[model samples]
Target: MSSETETFSISGPSHLTAIDWKNTYHRRCVVASLVQGVYILERDRQQNRIGSQKALAPLWWNFFHFQLNNMLVDSADHSIFGAIFELKPCLNAPRFVIAFRGTLIESGTRSRDIHLDLKCIVNRLHKSSRFQLAIHSIQETIGLAGASNVWLAGHSLGSAIALLAGKNMTKMGYPLETYLFNSPFVSAPLERIKDQKVKHGIHIASSVVKAGLTVALKCQHKQSKPQQDDPFVVLSYWIPHLFVNPADHISSGYIDYFAHREKMEKIGAGKIEKLATKHTVESLLSGAILDRISEPLHLLPSAELTINKSDSTNFRKAHGIEQWWDPTIHCPSLVYQYRY
Candidate 1:
């Protein structure tokens, strides 16, 4: 019993077993799936309203105000979906889960904000005006709850929004964690276009230039108004857990690749060294197989539900949120087997 609870300052891959990392990965995956489910629900309702020519009301506000007051208030500026929960005493801490809805189907009433999507890739400040307003709404709700911590989660485009929002929120002195599922590469990844020779060359050159600029910016950041606990540094350490499926081309099948790289960097920080070398090792042993290979040796045919059966016309299903939480299919066995 003493050995199990022993404390030491030693750090390395040796200190952490494969099972520990597996459990952590699976746990985060489950949370990501739940977040994706929330986004799916929000998206579905929005689409339904669009089809019927009626705007979808922000239903989360009802729950938000219900816990605080009996009177119902309608506010239309809140574009993002979010919920507030009243937990048991042990979990009495003020908590929030802000879920962002994915891309609009036709951009019928949202054309002006479309440019923000592309702009966000280059400038984090270029978030959609809707998201900007949503942040204000979130802040108001947090004030009402006296929230000490926030969890930002989203799927697809929402994931991108969540990342930007989380970054900004942390800068504003909020303790937050972001869980992103099948998040598309807001900034292009070098590996994403490796197969395209022309594009790969262009990406490589761009990467070189970007690296130089990044180094310069870091140097400038260090010299100008250096605070002991810089928010950007805090944000860097609070790495967003990103979950991706190999078939999820919206994420370019490389989001997991980048995430794996960052994960290794995080584990190997300071005196700690990463144990797993290959992404497959982490994915297979950790039971977080977000990536699916086209061909697997001795591969038993997984249930059809695991794979999207939709035609090309239904690209949305290809990046479907449903697949993330489908216990009968994509979900890892460990998730459903235990309480998590």
Candidate 2:
């Protein structure tokens, strides 16, 4: 993330409201679940549990509708992993999904260590030749062919890269949907200026001092471009439905913040406040999330997320991609709605 992206400069993704509500909700949920599968495989890779061959057997075994098309391993850095898959939601209609894996948490003697360095964000934002070449290679290999709809899905650090990729692809005239879970703030400039943890455990131990240095190096290397021309700015205009657990310290579960709700309220007021005046942004946001996915709001009773109170376990579970998306354990509902 950069100073230019202090606020979401780009809009969200195309609303899924144009489609059927039930199908939309199902699609969003399924996409998120499939994305979780990718994260699982990465975790397996990190733990050295992967056997003789690397396969998406986990995803295939877990999600029947999702078919792995190709595994995208960055040739420059084998550690970076992503995948392209085809999903048949209903009626066997295929939806192409491009997903990126998040940071691998390395188990340590005390706390877990994040494997992917945050500096990658600065490099991605600066459009480093190496990063750009890798992205171009992915595009060439995937070569969006006969794809009626394309979605960019990622969790945590992967979400940051997906945000950049989605915004750029949209600017290039692609109508792409996106789903990000427990996404970290993408602005390096903003993080440096704020000097605060935007997301839980995200401001790397070294980042406190190095963030400024990272920004300075980027500033010196790249010529300034108009803010509007910046992809992140474009991303702010598109409303991508970001699924975050309210208890997720890693993402800071900012969605439950009163200020965040207030901001969302303003966006609804301008567009769909016709439903009711008394509804808070949190409530309507649930509806909007459903609508964007073409699903009518069900307004189900609120549910409690059963997370252990211990710090490490809690953080791990709250930030867990699978736990966050699990309907049985975590359901999207207004905090107030549930309490009352």
- Point to the candidate with the largest lDDT: 2
Each candidate's lDDT (Cα)? 0.41, 0.45
Clashes by residue pair, model 1: none
In order of appearance, the predictions have TM-scores of 0.52, 0.54
Candidate 2 per-residue lDDT, tens place, 1-340, comes to 1121111112111222233425545555566555655655555555554552543335421344467676655444444357777755544334567777676543420121142434442232324332364356446534654423566777776665665565556556553566666666322222223333353133232222233433333365453657665433433345455555545554543332323223334554312211221232333344344432111111111212123222334666667665543334535433312111
Off by over 4 Å in 1: 1-95, 106-113, 122-127, 146-149, 192-209, 215-232, 252-315, 328-340
Candidate 1, 1-340: lDDT as tens digits: 1111111111111222222213544334334433433443344444564332242222222222212121111133223344332322224222455666555444432443355455544343333465665567557656765545455666766666676666566557664656666566533344445465665345334434434443444464453534435333444334555555545566643433333334434544311112121112212322323332111111111111112222423456457554443333433221100000
Best by TM-score: 2
Off by over 4 Å in 2: 1-21, 43-56, 60-62, 88-94, 106-116, 120-134, 141-143, 146-148, 186-237, 253-313, 329-340
**Residue 147, candidate 1: how far off, in angstroms?**
3.9
Worst-scoring 10-residue span by lDDT in model 2: 4-13
State how far residue 148 of model 1 sits from its true place (Å): 4.4
